[model samples]
Target: MTTFAPPAGPVTGALPLPVRRRPGFSLEGPFYTSAEIFAEDIDRVFSSQWIFAGTEAEIPRTGDYLTVTFGHQSVIVIRDGDDVRAMHNVCRHRGTRLLDETCGTVGNIVCGYHKWTYRTNGELMFAPAQPPNFDKTCFALRSVHVRSLDGLIFICLAADPPADIDTVAGLVSPYLAPHGLKNAKVAARSEIVEHGNWKLVMENNRECYHCDNHPELICTFFPTYGYEPDEIPPNLLPAYDRFLAAENDLHAKCDAAGLPYEAIEELDGRDVGFRIQRESLDGAGESFSADGSAVCRRSLGGFTDKRLGRLSMHVQPNFWSHVLSDHAVVFSVLPLTVSTTVVRTTWLVDAEAEEGIDYDLDELTTVWNHTNEQDGEIVARAQLGVSSPAYEPGPYAPSEYQVEKFCSWYIDAMNAGEPRPEPAGRSTGESG
Candidate 1:
């Protein structure tokens, strides 16, 4: 077995290295190309950390279930009457996979290979043609730790969690509450497979540094492009606090008004100066808007006593929350290999809201889909460039604080010698 090397730093228990004081702009190259580094990251980061699973809305009815993956492990998220459960999808008898479909309802789970069966609640039910000495009670589907925030589901592979759900919630609650995510429902889903380290995709998502190169998509939303490190907006500086105060204030107002709130939309074209002229590579007329108000109104809606159209927030690591007037959107980045990743996105709305009648979901989906495609194209190319012998790590611009902060945190996690905080309600036995 390959032993993991912690990042460079003084001994601080078993954690990785400490982030350098100077602008640490680049990750070690091995992170992008080494299978050993990938394995270490899976052990240290993905396994111990809280990962966003599918939302509660995906399995709203009893016996409903959805299959997901963490690292290479297949898992199932199921509604067992009153509680939602997450279990390893592998069968105990000879270890054949229990579920092959992505999702479905089965009164009882039956392993096709040996006909081993389990109840929807994860209890071992029976085994056909078993050895006389085989014990059914001794084997059961392994369970993972799970928690729900608003209606979104999170799972942890670690057996012993370092923190409670409320603490984790506190870290992101400010942003989540404003968008009303706790009661949100799923509307649409999409996925993108990219050829690059997962971190590459995350690095791109955390910064608007490439806005200048995106002629059609993001440039339309943010025309003033700046690749220099020094150009960060003052309000967005100190990345962690960027939307905390604003979100808290919004939540307070909602509470005072007795309104069911989830999240706020952060896509007001006005904030980013939508009226500014931008050049397009397609030779389409120079893009210009009279004001951001039109775009915001169309996407979010008018702010009134009863409605506050949209709000957007990002939790450190790799989750993005786009809170629209009547719904919410979430995006997650999952690493498949050192150079491959699976990107998943979901649109959420009120469980009671009727699709097409309550909102035109296609309108909202189109904007995000186009935006993601644009992002994917750019990052894929960047990945190819990074692999080039001529490529070198660059310095950070003052204005690109968001991207810088993300890098800083990633380095800290990679170098920390100690284990990361665990997800809620998990113990070591529960982790694989």
Candidate 2:
């Protein structure tokens, strides 16, 4: 197996620091306009990188299974007796998809075209009308690397394991473990199809630089742009701080507030932290602040660590996790064409938390879905505008560091000349 190397530090003069007294930016023209670049991206980026498949909670039983798409490939995650396995969702008989449904429990996966039976564990258990000399062992389902982190599931297409999932988990565990993600359950799921590139969706989610345009939906929750942790309401800050600042007393407060205790715990425990800094925009009509100090506001209010409310996180590339004190939601981005992307968002809650009793997830879902639709409209228009012959790559606001980080990461990965594996981490085991 080929051992994976962690990304190296920025070499001297390799990536120069951003220009001073002016915003700095770079845009590779072909990334958004060329079909060839898109194809290469699928192979080098999506296929190799860890892609969210599903949650282990989605398939709790021995025979439980879920079918999902990784890029254009069909894959299945199933429970096989005592082991959980991920395999290509293809029938050996005629290369047809074995299971067409999104999710379910099955005794055996039997192809509709021909009666080829495979155990839930992905072993070719039975095959009808095989020649006397036929060997079933060689025909077993093709296996893919699978691992679970918290409850999230991830799968990689490459034959050799790219990197240690545990290492990846260690990096983000401090941020996720406190939220009870390890034990969380799926409460609901929804999808949206947008008319823009997948990258556009990611860029939008990476920074909160465009929230005012849709204030009615976002301001109800996150009402301010101040970065001082104290400037925000205790309920608005992540939970970990409460644990440290107030001892365990905050845990009770969080529980009483209906927030996810573990998430807050993780946030507080994290070595590397996040801060929200904002700067008011002037009349120049730019969406961001002149100094890039502030982010755009949208439906900011949701859940926080204090209660099962709302919080948002961008997990590099095309995945996002939105945590509400009571529940959590995840989103995956799939690019269909240069100008089109399909987004799937799923809402998760504790299995015991009844929908209406604990919280109205649908209300939260409606708000977030609408927010996504609004983003779609804006990004689509942006795509059209950028495609104009007169357009030039503009400067990045200094405060828009998240956006800068994202663009820098993408460029670095592309320049590395190697396949990008799923962000190194264990899967949550849920398939969307």
The list of candidate 2 runs beyond 4 A from truth reads 1-23, 81-83, 220-312, 417-432
State each model's C-alpha RMSD to the native. 9.3, 11.0
Candidate 2 lDDT by residue in tens digits, 333-393: 7777777777877766666666666646545466566777788898888777656776566
Error of 1 at 387 (Å): 1.2
TM-score of every prediction relative to native: 0.72, 0.70
| Cα deviation of 174, candidate 1, in Å | 6.0
Residues 12-44, candidate 1, lDDT per residue (tens digit)?
Answer: 334333223335465545666677566656656
Q: Model 1 scores what on Cα lDDT?
A: 0.59
Best by lDDT: 1
Off by over 4 Å in 1: 1-22, 171-183, 212-309, 416-432
| Residue 387 shift from truth in candidate 2, angstroms | 3.8
Deviation (Å) of 96 in candidate 2: 2.1
